[model samples]
Target: MAKSKVEYVCTECGDVSPKWAGQCAACKGWN
Candidate 1:
């Protein structure tokens, strides 16, 4: 298998950030 860039998107809002935050800045939730 080859290595690919991974990403995490917020469920509440379509905010694609590099890392996870305590509260989603987009959704404003503890996700």
Candidate 2:
């Protein structure tokens, strides 16, 4: 089976992240 890819999006800045983080890199907002 193929492995599924995961992504995290910031609601405030609409930034795409490969992994989950406490804050967004683009807007510096909490995720």
Candidate 3:
């Protein structure tokens, strides 16, 4: 089985992040 993981996805550019941030690294959108 695959390990469970938590991530944050960018709503604008469909970017995935392992941790939460104020801005998206992919689209530079405010989260």
Cα deviation at 20, candidate 2, in Å, is 0.6
Better of 1 and 2 by lDDT: 2
Off by over 4 Å in 2: none
Q: Write the per-residue lDDT of candidate 2 for residues 1-31, one digit (tens) a residue.
A: 9999999999998999999888999999997
Candidate 3 ranges with C-alpha deviation above 4 Å: 1-3
Residue-level lDDT of model 3, residues 1-31, one tens digit each, is 9999999888888899999897998889998
lDDT of 2: 0.94
TM for candidate 2 is: 0.85
lDDT scores in order: 0.77, 0.94, 0.90
lDDT by residue (1-31, candidate 1, tens digit) is 9988777788777788787776778778666
Q: Which candidate, 1 or 3, would have the higher lDDT against the true structure? A: 3
Better of 1 and 3 by TM-score: 3
Which one wins on lDDT? 2
Ranking by lDDT, best first?
Answer: 2, 3, 1
